[model samples]
Target: MSGSSKKPMRRAVVPVSKTLPTDPQDQHSSSEEVDPIFFTPSPSPPSNTPTPDNASALPCDHATGEPHRHPNPTRHPDFWFHDGSIILQVESKLFKIHQTILANHSEVFAGLFDVPPPLPTGTTEGDDMVLEGCRIVVLHGDTEKDFESLLRAVYNPSYFDDTLPPSADVETLLDFISGILHLSTKYLIRNLRQRCINLFTSKFPATFDEYTAKSTPQPSYSSTRSSSHKQERYRSDTLMRALHLAHSCNITTSLPYLYYCTARLSLHRLLKPRPTDVDWQTKSVVLAGRERLRYATLAISYSFLLVFERAPTCAEMRCGFASGPGREWRSIVLGGESGIGSAPTPPTAATSITNAGGVNGISASATAERKSKSSSNRAPNPLRLYTRWPELGVCDRCVEWNKGVHERGRREVWERLPGMFELEGWDELRKAQGS
Candidate 1:
């Protein structure tokens, strides 16, 4: 959403891509992002540009089914096109396509319940990065606290007070967990988490991590059941989770507890009047600048566990280009690996590092973006994001990331971060943590 997310790149230590050597004159300018010789558009393109806002550009796919993938990977970026395409130019390649379309068609379910009014249908503001889903008003300050509040407001009793007829609550909950069907709760949580995670990861990876780690720890639940008839008691016990995730699914036993449990924890703090994380204002920027619907999986859970994996530049540590060679230093910036001879910056600081906005040290990102745009050189058509998804959830991105990190030796790399996975209160946990 903010910093262009990079793929785990691998190549020889030689200069892979060329950058227009910072002109001494241009270099005098106080910014890092290199300006394109021909500036066709900007993220903050003015309201007057011929930006399209066709609601149909939004994809309506579900998180459960085979996630909609661009039929033509040769067509666009991972996201579906909602309004227009982001045109990127790298050397000779160009690609363009709408990357944030939702094909789920299940948003109608939100209509059945009370959703905050649909975002302005035809607004000209979105080509930037993230989508301002049905809620278009620009919010101000304290994103985390405000975001938490939004979660709570959404759980308003009226929203969930509607009782379903006698149906299998367990099946509905399972579908919600596995994302096999459309329920407002399932859609909102998955979409919101996906959207928020993406935007924060790209723009503010550190802040995202802080938010994720600090959002709220899920409540402990005793899943042990003495008998199957404990349904009524069980639901009553977990009412907190349900209110937080009013997805209107048939509630049941095997919902993995984490499904509703995690969301409840997040929303409880969200609904509060004045959360500690709040400052003067409230704002939640959906996955970088992409809209609520235009999401791309960057890492899966297993991958996420390996926090030490670094992007290309940091991974190899400034492999100085000897010819026109610039000063380079070997660094390990992730998971507290600040000690690898040279200090490597984490992805979170990417914005600050590239204030003027350069690709965050990875060459493939620019290439991928440019390649995606070139494909759309012709007069374009409405685009879509995914084809079909599974009930399994799109945590695949994190899983993929773990695979990359494991290959790099996660524990050794993570040693850089100060207390990465170090368990706390060893003395106390040792007293109780059972070796």
Candidate 2:
């Protein structure tokens, strides 16, 4: 490298013999006031100062007999702009980024740059250290990877864009998304923080209608796999991680739906500890919430039993009878062995139905059979929208009435979901999100 083109590495120094001028007029003319780049010997130590022989052994420079200064950190290849005005040292990595760009994006950075940085570790007050022709600032309590992610988002316009298709791998996106969310929040980068919040809420929506839309499986066929299968795989793998992120980031709007998804997880999966496992308090919340969800799902799924007055425009009177649509619908939902479209048995314990009453004058023996069959089936989904009414031998008018009632009950469940997990209502959550 050519010496002439390189910026001088300078350290601030003061003359040993320099003394304050007695006269005010002589102060400005003092020859001791030299440029910061010029090297001057330090003043001699006080008589009481420890000598090398008597002093406790310490790491020191062999040549100077002074404590060793920190080694120069390795420079980041991608982020070191030639025209960068500031250097940020995170751990053992150095990032050269434009101060104006960082300041424009984050108020924290703006205020940080407004005040002078503290003197470097070995230097006294009023001593400044310059590296690569820029002020070197040491950033504490931040990882190199996270700072890189924050810098990428600041420099690259499309870094956090939502241009990726729905089929894009989510785990890969979460890698950068998590880093950006963490650092952005710490740096007070409002736009990047909000972008992260939007991404989370999109997956775990606050509203019932939005949650339903997201939950509705849209199957895309491929040579080897279906889109619905891919989505399910993603959810099963990432739901816990996402829940932990939401809880850590304080994304209140997404917590309700995230907790709901967690509540649906099998007990084995819930209890299995992982590196990112949530706290015991959240685990307790999930357990309590699961019980609440199971009870609500059963009640909502069987709400049709309460419809004593049949639709006047029934296609057939038999459709309302115990041996007809009424009994058939109960069997299908309760997963009776004799019913069509019964769910397959889950590996876990069966969901038990309690406090259920006889429906449409069904006999006691028939009810017992229904209960017996239900005890072997998986839990009912609280968010389930029954669209198989036509296959259940139900008339159009009766189907319409039951569907309306089920939809309303599902909405009610969604509204109460947050409270089950010790969170605020949707309206309050939404307000907090906006704030």
Candidate 3:
């Protein structure tokens, strides 16, 4: 639909001025020049201007008056034939679709049909308009596979189900939903866009409070591995694509969370060059998101330092594990025992902050307090000190006290995520819809 034209359809504006600059340099002195300013031709565009590298050349058949017939015009199995009366083509694939059904769901299609077909007087049939022998519309600027996904959704009454089918793999469902988003957006289908957004937001949720309350935290190694694998289930490239779609479609609610999830990936993984197509704008967003995440993680670390600094010290000798010194607990929180060496020795006088640890592996450890160094090589999380606190080595009173601190600290950081990342408030973000 979009193509370059040698001559613009709209008339070009030509200026007619009565006055001219009096300065010698600005004036044309030649008598034959007609005072120069009275009649000035517009400058021609530079002949050497580079064409966009990303722009695809239109098929030669298009200019030669040859109909670009599809090589594989066979209809898809599930979507091929039904009670449909209209035909739509996406490149090689031809789809039999119902006009009324699509018109009802999409304002764009409805508006298209609202225009009376160019028929002879008294020669028109009912409301449905058939062109030549059939109502055919050829779609450009999208892949057949994407259109098929959208048509499948548009035709099926139960496509936007509240629950996913048991046979559906979560990742596959997400990809299809993303496809719906792409096509729906291109076609101006609001209902399908909203459905896709709702489903995607639910799948990759922003907060873990609802989930964490029910499931107990696993040990560090297993928890970290599980979180990594879960992230792997949906490839990073897919998430990046969805993020680009959200921005293009004005799906603001998904932006903050998508950005955060993308930022969570390690630099090596995030920076890995992929063959997949990505626009420059989306790539810029990802780079900026990395910086935003760093700032937020640093802020959370500072919060941990502040909380640990003010915590009441246990002077009683009966206090187990932590009886060595009040400062010992602070050391453990800042990775003093984790062998990261980033934390200040005297945690109370700490002036700098460190990186936040893994997302799902937050925990505390009293055994870590006793150990000269951590056994694992993972970066330490301040909240983990309280969540996975070695209860075996800690006194009952200290364990209970640590539990309250851990919960409060983790929740505080969670609440601060938006502010830390410079995103809109969580509540407002959740309510946003695609335009």
Candidate 1: regions farther than 4 A off: 1-167, 170-260, 263-269, 273-352, 355-435
The 10-residue segment of model 3 with minimum total lDDT is 51-60
Q: Which stretches of candidate 2 lie over 4 Å from their true place?
A: 1-72, 116-128, 161-166, 217-231, 234-237, 305-309, 312-316, 322-380
Over the stretch 1-435, how does candidate 1's per-residue lDDT look in tens digits? Answer: 545653222111211011221122221121334332211111233333332233222221122222112211122233223443232222211223221222122242222222122334443233312233432111111132333222232334331123222343543432222222112222233443333223222211122233234232344455454322221222322333332222122221111122212222223343343432221121121111111111111121122221323333333332111111011111111111111111222232112333212355455455434533432221110011111122212234432443454434322222212121122222322222111
Q: Using Cα atoms with residue i matched to residue i, what is each candidate's TM-score against the true structure? A: 0.15, 0.68, 0.57
lDDT, candidate 2, 28-136, per-residue tens: 2234342221221222233443322132211223235343233435679998888887767776676878888999997667755663543333333222334455555
- Candidate of highest TM-score: 2
Candidate 1 has an lDDT of 0.25
* Residue 100, candidate 2: alpha-carbon lDDT: 88
lDDT of 1 at 346: 22
Computed on alpha carbons, the lDDT of every model, listed in order, comes to: 0.25, 0.59, 0.47
The candidate that achieves the highest lDDT relative to the unseen native structure = 2
Give per-residue CA lDDT, model 3, range 257-328, as digits (tens). Answer: 566556555556665767753444445565665554433333453343334322255544444323233344
Between candidates 2 and 3, the lDDT winner: 2
Candidate 1's displacement at residue 424, Å, is 13
